[model samples]
Target: MALDTAKKSQIIAKFARKSGDTGSTEVQIALLTARISELTEHLKINKKDFSSRLGLLKLVGQRKRLLRYLKATKYDTYAKVVSELGLRDK
Candidate 1:
């Protein structure tokens, strides 16, 4: 259950720094978050899907690394993204 182009573009557009800015760290993290959520829901219904579970873990790790990079290199942007995405407890 991969993300379709429309959904991918929506997430990219929301986080993109500029027009057509698909490769930015914010956009990538948002995309991964979306995918991870989708996979998490799938796992809830299909608990035996080990492959998808592994994929979810990989996505989580990647998003964690990206968030760390953003925090180290651009703390303001990291904070902004985290707030906008509603990630992390208050």
Candidate 2:
């Protein structure tokens, strides 16, 4: 299930680097993480949902790439984001 607008705004606000920063990388990663988690829960109950599983994998890949980029350019912020989201260290 995709995050609603309200939830999306909340995440954006929480991870935003500055006011009205919806398109920043941190916000993007946070949003993807939220979606990834939601899809994970959905898959847990619907084992036969191959389509959702594929989508979930894609989201994970996207989040991974974004995290890699973040770590490359801003290690401090990357570490903060990863820890805040409870993601595994690389």
Candidate 3:
């Protein structure tokens, strides 16, 4: 129905950091990624959900921009995230 547990935990851990992570980029990106995945499944059964589709697209764009930022500032972290999220490599 949704992404696997290991991947979900990885994203959740990044988003819910222990300390010194207030308004952190990783947290923001992870949260957006989770939303995107949620909306994806929602749209799967409700294929006629235009509004949800729009929201999903927006989240995907947000995540894409965040990935670009991560790649620019921290390539390794970006790679790890994309791989965990199963996003495209290039």
Candidate 4:
């Protein structure tokens, strides 16, 4: 149920600042969001997957921290990422 390299690369490419910018906050948040969504879907079908639930919570916390950092350091980029990802309410 983990994300494959191809999917990870796709997220990085879409959210990265440049071609090789994989460690940026935007990219990391995007990757976490993807994993969070995947795990959420997994949980829908497998309610007893406690390990995956923990993982999903961790990813969500990581994403929240990253978004907090981005919002503090670069509001424009943070707004752009949030708008692009459709995560406005959160």
In order, the Cα lDDT scores of the candidates are 0.92, 0.94, 0.75, 0.90
Q: Write the per-residue lDDT of candidate 2 for residues 1-90, one digit (tens) a residue.
A: 979999999999999989999988899999999999999999999999999999999999999999999999999999999999999996
Which sections of candidate 4 miss by over 4 Å?
none
User: How well is each residue in 1-90 modelled by candidate 4, as lDDT tens digits?
Assistant: 778999999989998888899999999888888888899998999999999899888888899989999999999999999998889645
Q: Give me the overall lDDT of model 1.
A: 0.92
lDDT tens readout by residue for model 3, 6-74: 876666676654755645667777767777877888888899999888878888888888888889998
- Give a tens-digit lDDT track for model 1, residues 1-90: 789999999999899999989999999999998898899999999999999999899998899999999999999999999999889933
User: Candidate 4: what lDDT?
Assistant: 0.90
Off by over 4 Å in 3: 1-12, 15-22
Score candidate 2 by TM-score against the native: 0.96
Candidates sorted by TM-score, descending order?
Answer: 2, 1, 4, 3
**Residue-pair clash count for candidate 4:** 0
Note the clash tally of each candidate: 0, 0, 0, 0
Runs of candidate 2 exceeding 4 Å displacement: none
Number of the top lDDT candidate: 2
Taking all chains together, the TM-score of candidate 3 against the true structure is 0.73
